[model samples]
Target: MLTATKMFMIVFTLLSIIKSVTLSACDEQEILDISDGELLPNGDVVFDGVVYENRDYFINNVTGIKTACPKLVINKCCPFGTGYKTRQCVNITDSFDAPVWDRYKLIEGARAREMFRFRIGKINCTRPYARVLVSQIGQLDWSDNWHLKSDGKLFVELDSSIPPWTVQPPDKYCIDTFVYEDQDGKTHTRLDALACFLDETPPNHFEVRSTCMLLSCAFILITVAVYAWLPELRNMHGRVLMAYLLCLFVGFILMASMQIMLTIDNITPHICVVLTIVIYFALESAFFWLNVMSFDIWWTFSGKGGMTSKKMSKRFCAYSLYAFGVPTILTIILTSLEFSGLPPHPLLPMVRYQGCFLFGRSKLLYLYGPMFFLCLANIVFFIMTALRIARIKHETEMLKSKESAMHDQHRKDKQRLLLYLKLFTVMGINWILEVISALYPDADYIWCFTDVYNVLIGVTIFIIFVCKRKIFRLIKKRIKENFTNSKNNSEELKYKRTIPTRLCEDSQHQRGSVETIRTTIGMENGVTAEANTTIL
Candidate 1:
């Protein structure tokens, strides 16, 4: 009896040792040195030839057991702390690959819980019951709001309005599809058609948005052209206006092109990223230029000495430095954060990670934040200039409209201030609408109204600046000059054709001498110095 008992003890000890070795071998081979690993469908993570059962399992077990902690990380990890990574919105033809679906089958039964809050992407669901059909996890109603329980289970309340297809709710979390094999080795499948992979926006939505943006871009180009073509408009003020409009034009065109490409399924991820940076830079530069205009107006009315042509040129160079330099720095910062591999945060402009453009908090903080401050500054400048103008008026009441040269300049400056005010108001309204739309995305009517207003922005600007009486007179003047020059050319050709070569040459010499004599006399009479102060 004693011998038999001793033999049993030895066998039991051997079995325990073998079991520990077997478990340790699996751990050593498959659970060590996992960094930046990707989560698999079967509640496992695989990277660098190593695997862990789930994100939690990797985190919990890899401590002290491996030199490095096992981590499940993915790129574009925006909408952080939401327990998911958001991908760029894609079109119908850009759905998950067949291989992805094949691996998706592994997420059955308890494995579903591993992907509890995995986000695929946002969808523009047209169907009334689209959300209900897309979600299968816990038979929960589709909601942006998510809840996590202490036991690591995800729970969502059901909406009674959504009719239930199954009598019993699902015990596990799964979306789009659920596949499993029973003890009998029979595969059971439950599939729901999620419209997420379909066209994200309505077909007409892109067309309308793109058309409005393109229209705006065309008007912006026209505005720039007007400034470029007219010497009167090519002064310090005109240069600033042209620069601002050109930046606005670039932003609008690039944005419209990106949307059109998305609609046609022609844009690649890389191109989307590049266009996003360019658009951001252009838009920011435009705002800076607008700010420069406000500052210049304030400075003009600040009782400073009048500017000469050389001084005006130097000041314009300074304005260009501020307007262009700041946006370049901002763009560099945005690009650096994108490529720096830094952990996701609310402050960073994760342009590449989130989507093609700024969204959510990033949009508000980066795009609107600077604009809000600049607009505020513009208002302050306008107020200060108005106060200074009032003071000047009080002092010059006796000389009201008496000094033609000084009064004319003051009138021109006042006109410029009014023009700036109109432009500021228009842009300010646009910014406000953008903020509202972003904050309350479900307000479809607001989106529609914003789109209509976008089209009217360019129209309104054209009316405010280009459609003025003064602008019309300038246009007429330019046309008359061109016509007169053409007529003179024709007259000269006729004179040359009718006359002999020798006689024509002699007449040309005499005419040149006579013109020089007349120009000399004119200079002698009209040599008065006129103040050429440029109102930027």
Candidate 2:
């Protein structure tokens, strides 16, 4: 009985030793027996050899044991062209590649929450490729699955249907395609693309090309409108209005051309981009000229001339033409030089958009340089004009008390000047506000609001000033008729009272004789006085 008991003890001790060895081996293998439907870290679970990189997991919402496992594997697959068959059984422990071992290390660390992800490259399987994973353990599982078949390959099906990647056939393929990995370890396939295409459909090309032609036609029409309506617009400070309209027309034409050129995908030749830049400068020049015209009007009418013999009208006309003409000619020359590749002209390269835009250091010199000058010019002219108007007003007030008729004439002149000044002031303020808003577009909301206000004011001014002449005439006629009636009533009241019959008859006869002589003398005297006044 003692011998049997001893033998049983020995067997029991051996069984215990074997069980411990089996447990240690399982630990070494890192076999993760995760349950189904359990959301691991990143909405995935470790199973077999597939590493599931979660694409849409929010780390903050996870809890419990799943929280500890920040990265879980959902699928395992070998690299591309792997011919491994059979889905479930795989032994990757002894035959795994070095990269696979490295990947396993990353997974172990991730499982310990020490790292966020792992990347393994060049694992030698049927088709070897680099892979990214949420954990190194997940990568090991994938390798194990890859080695499941004797062919040493793994096939991992995508959880989502792969999108069909298409390109405009080879003839139209100006761009290239690239593969990129996202943070979630998923690969994103993209076709290299540009903002626009050179060989767009005929309709699209036509539409783009027609934009400039249409705008050019519109400008032509606006010029016609200005010419035909000049007489009417003239009364309401028409010259400046015409300038503004012309600037708008030219600006639209240039802008449309630039936009059309920019839309073509790959045909932005350096010449074309340069032309666009030139056109942009031309448009800017036109805008500045418009501002200059406004300033001229302000200076002319703002009472700045006072009684000074400045020949302001002729000077203004000459200066305006020179102002517009000089810049226009210079811009044309510069643009021609740039396009013709002349010396001293900057050479720009063609870029992704076909033509380079105003970018880099050249942009500041080329684009903002003119703008700075324009702003300075506007400031100088505006202040000078305002001061002149104040001086004229003071002079007019001083002259008013000494001479009634002269004062009335002065008042009419002042009214006319004020009308023009007001018009130009509106334009000057609008331009200044627009420039300021452009400089600090993000800081204030006033720019947008003021632009809308300016449009409304422009339309309102046109209506008010253009229709004012007729309204004023009608008012004057009504006032004249009222004054004439009042005068007649006062004369009738004086004549209706007291006249003696006898004296009236006798006086009538004497008065008739005397009236004839008096009338003849009065008529001769009146004719002589009128002739003398006319001669004088």
Instruction: Judging by TM-score against the true structure, name the best candidate.
Output: 1
lDDT (10s digit) by residue, model 1, range 1-536: 56988998787667545544544545454544444666576646555533444433323232423222323221211122222212222122222211111111222233322323233323334543233333444454333222233232333433221111112112233233323356798854432223222223334466788899999887777777777877888888899988898898889899889878877767666777799889999999999999999999999988688789999899999999999999999888888887788766777776654546786678888888888898999999999989988888788764386667777788789889999999999998998999998788557778787888888888887888799888889989998998999999999999888779878799999987876666666567773223111110
Residue 380 error, candidate 1, Å: 1.0
TM-score of each: 0.61, 0.37
- Writing each residue's lDDT as its tens digit, candidate 2 over 1-536 gives 56998999787667545544544454434533333334555555433333323431212212322112333211213322121222212222222121211211222222211222211112221212222221122243222221111111122222211111111211121111223456797854332211112222223332433353454445444443643444433432355446555554555455455555545543335545555555555556555665565465565555454433256456656756765776676566545644564332233321112233443333445555565676667667656756665676687665547567756655554565555456546555755665555456444465455535444443544543444665457556656877899999888866675446666999989877775665566667775545444443
- Pick the lDDT winner: 1
Clashes of 1: 0
Worst 10 residues of 1 by lDDT: 95-104
The Cα error of candidate 1 at residue 45, in Å, is 37
